[model samples]
Target: MSNENVAILMSTYNGEKYLEEQVKSIISQDYTDWHLYIRDDGSTDSTVNLIKKIARDNEKITFLNENKPKNLGVTGSFMDLLANTKAQYYMFSDQDDYWMEDKISATLRKMQASEIDHMPICVHSNLTVVDTNLHGDSLMNSSEEHWSDFKSMLFANCVTGCTMMINQELKNLLDFDKVKSNKLYVHDWWIALVAAAFGKVVYLDRSTILYRQHQGNVIGSNKKTTLFNKNEPFNGRVIRMVKITSDFWQAYGSKLTGQNKNYVKNYASLVQHRNPLWNLRIVLKYPPARATTTGNLVFGSIVVRDYQKLSRLG
Candidate 1:
């Protein structure tokens, strides 16, 4: 290759069934200034061997073995890979998903063109969720506003990890060492939140990936599995609520850095008090990013005139 400007960080764990197809799709990209920085997290199958076979012949794909005595899980694997890269642009990839051809080109264009490129703006796209057999089942879409930067950055995950493309500064800032490095990372939720606080988050709605969902997924599908599906619930809604609220409170209140620390503190406080006024203010105050937040929190409905204006843009 002539150069290496983009670094693709992919994390794989027991993904043999779909690994080859996904890897082939990545290699088929129209863009040439890129390399696949991959780490296979102790697969018991021939998945690592499959990667090693192709990687041996292709210099662009660098296969990093887990040097750790134990598997670091997905977050630690990414941390390790992120530290090892020196590319201008950084992205995270899921093992089982196939990216659209224009995915990187579109993200790179927006990133290179944005005035806030120095800041972390997450350029994401719409994803079509598919079954194991690659049949389209649902749409795992992107956020319309900058809220994915805020809300996802705050409590719950609003954006999918696979559809994201972040910048260099964004990568450096969110890396564990830059700010709040000591906290345990629940994969990329903290990283996205930090990204929103520091940079602008863009929603590129073009469908750009085939996100495959199966029972083994860390965060499985929202719907029940089909015929072979275990489709088991994580208990009832109330029990799920208990854990979710706890996670939100902790992530939001934890000693975070940059602008989010303040926002998180305020949010945790508001939710603790069970106040409607806070959401109302959030709805009224933040624009573009918090449209849904406002509509859901503040007035049950937006002012008709404002809603109509936003609708036209959509």
Candidate 2:
């Protein structure tokens, strides 16, 4: 871990409120062989100035696209950072979250121990959810079963970008063009999907960062949401999944193994085909999106309703 070099990629918009705290936390990290690269997404506030102030004093902290900044959303900004940076290992960071002192060192150690030679590897850990004041709200435990299957990953994302670290092999495999065309939900999910399919996805049980939840976040953790909305319609989600799945197949299907390719095709069919039996068959063949049995059961029950709607249409 001491010999390895890491590049931390962060995307910022109107993050002036918590940006300084986050930057200071990274500077205070116990691991010292890392550089921070931050890209601002056409911020109207003083976010750019704040990041520029930090970069002026530190050689390792780089402010990207300062002269001609483009308003590429959060996903696009991160993708831009990913395309340009090179390092032995890469990490994604949010502009507002404060990391634990040993976060990088701990995750890097885990990656080194579990890494397979010549294969893309990624390691991510649990995060402690906190409020704007940095008060510990709750814990989002990601210590469940390994989510390595393509079918499971197609439906849900278990890895969060702020807590993720990827090796050079994975970095080389990233296709920026495909992500830009596919309208990927986020950079982290795409990376997680690739790691699950092509290499190893390691999950560390310990919480390593203070994940701040606020109104300005692009995505927020929902620890307090109700279990299931029985009346919620699946039509909108199904439509979005169809487009995403088609785009994904067009982009990365050639790199997938025979087994994974078959699973993705079948899963895509289950969503697109109006046949109830195909849905039932797919449900029986592939495990649910969630890893636990009870979680899978609950997931299946909701899908059953959607399949019933398809049956009625047919």
Q: For candidate 1, write residues 1-314 as lDDT tens digits.
A: 23338889987888888888888888888787889988877777777777787688789998877443236687777776777788787878888888888777877776666635366666665678888877885775324322455544343344566777777777766534533322334445556665666676666666678888887775553442111113543222212222333344464445456555554444333334333444336434532223355333323222221333222221
Best candidate (score: TM-score): 2
lDDT of 2 by residue, 165-275 (tens): 999898777877656722566677778778878888888888899999999887775342112223334354443444455556766788777867876666556545665
Off-target runs (Cα >4 Å) in candidate 2 are 224-241, 269-287, 291-314
lDDT of 1 at 299: 30
Instruction: Specify the highest-lDDT model's number.
Output: 2
Clashes of each: 2, 0
Error of 2 at 138 (Å): 2.2
For candidate 1, the TM-score is 0.69
Range of the 10 consecutive residues with the lowest summed lDDT in candidate 1: 234-243
RMSD of each: 9.5, 4.0
Model 1 spans with C-alpha error above 4 angstroms: 1-4, 66-69, 142-153, 178-185, 221-262, 266-314
